[model samples]
Target: MTDAELDLVFKALADPTRRRIIERLDDHPGQTLFEVCAATLAEDGSGLSRQTISQHLDILERAGLVRTARKGRTKIHTADLSPLRLVAGCWLGRFIQED
Candidate 1:
């Protein structure tokens, strides 16, 4: 990934709520807005409203972390793995020194 792409990914991940949303999508794979909101309440007990979760999802989508598909009238959101793995391999991989 390019630096700009990495920046976007990192920026999106900077928010705890967005990270939680990513985790939720990781576990659930594909979930509609309502399903995600329910999961957040069950796990965090934050009672975050659907609107708040929707906004978070929007940010994730913009950062190329979350992908959405239309199923009839509902939008199903899924986590994209390539960007996360790329970011980890790019930045976190530096920790492993090859002597």
Candidate 2:
């Protein structure tokens, strides 16, 4: 990924809420807005509003971290870890020492 794209991905993951959303979708693929909100509340009791989660999802989408599709009238979200893995391999992986 280009530096700008990498920047976007890093920026998207910089937020804890965004990271949680990524984890949620990673564990359970294809979730709606309401379902995400419910699951997050059930897990942490944060009671975050649907709007807040929606906003976070938007950032994830822009960063290529989340993929969204329309299933009938409902919009579903899924985590896309390709960018994250690319960043890790290109950047973070360099620091690892081979045994």
Candidate 3:
């Protein structure tokens, strides 16, 4: 990933809500906006608005952390960890040595 793309990935993960959203999508892929909202509420009792979650989803999508697809009339979201794995392997992995 380019510096800008890495920046976007880091930025997207910088937020607590976005991280939680990523966690949600990771555990359960292909969830609609409403299902995401419901799961978030059920998990933490957070009263986050749908619009707020939608905005977070947008950020994740831009960072290549989340992917969205149309399921009939609804849009379902899934987590894509390639960028994260790339970052970990290419950037962070350099810091550690195999024993």
* TM-score of each model, paired residue for residue: 0.86, 0.91, 0.92
Tens digits of lDDT, candidate 2, 1-99: 689988999999999989999999999999999999999899878989889999999999999999999999999999999998899888767786354
RMSD of each: 1.8, 1.4, 1.4
Off by over 4 Å in 3: none
Stretches of candidate 1 above 4 Å error?
A: 96-99
Model 1 over residues 1-99: C-alpha lDDT tens digits?
788888889899998888998988988887999999988888888978888999999989988899999989888999997888888798867876454
Model 2, residue 83: C-alpha shift (Å) = 0.5
Q: Rank the candidates by lDDT, best first.
A: 2, 3, 1
What is the TM-score ranking, best to worst?
Answer: 3, 2, 1
Report lDDT per candidate: 0.88, 0.92, 0.92
Let me know the TM-score candidate 2 reaches against the reference structure: 0.91
**Which digits, one per residue and each the tens of the lDDT, describe model 3 over residues 8-69?**
99999999889999998999999999999999899879999999999999999999999999
Considering only N, C-alpha and C atoms within 3 Å, which residue pairs clash in candidate 2?
Answer: none
Superposition error at 5 for model 1 (Å): 1.1
